[model samples]
Target: MNSLKTVWAIAWRRFSENSAIAAEMNGRFIATVFYCTVLVPFGILSALFMDPLRIKGKPPRWLQREPVPTDMDSARRQG
Candidate 1:
């Protein structure tokens, strides 16, 4: 009985010491999974649908056959 108690006490002590490390590892794994499965896929889908960079807004000047006139002529003149 004393040897069993000693083993149990040692096991409890070791578990107490390592609990923080074990919790931190679990937290990091969960965060990584959330980032990969949720955040990454959401970001990709949003980028696909939303055009965050506004790449579709205007053609590059070099790509345009004719120079496009600006709608804000007064602003251009002021600049």
Candidate 2:
């Protein structure tokens, strides 16, 4: 009877402590799924289709001097 009470007390304390950690782990798991399944793919597709979404910033001096081709043929063909 004494050992059962001790184990129950320990189990309750552990549950209280671990509940918050479990909630945080759950949040991170959800965010990871959101990024992998939705946000990242949408960002990539939108950037590919739209020009404004793609360009990060102004071109460097060398890039400005040497014109970069935008054609599909200019890009490496991988098959």
lDDT of 1 by residue, 1-79 (tens): 9999999999999998899889999999999999999999999899778976777878676643775566798568866
Query: How many backbone collisions does model 1 have?
Result: 0
CA lDDT, every prediction? Answer: 0.88, 0.85
Candidate 2 residue-wise lDDT, 4-65, digit = tens: 99999999999988998999999999999999999999999987776774456656555335
- Report model 2's TM-score to 2 decimal places: 0.49
Q: Quote the lDDT for 49 in model 1.
A: 88
C-alpha root-mean-square deviation, each candidate: 9.0, 13.3
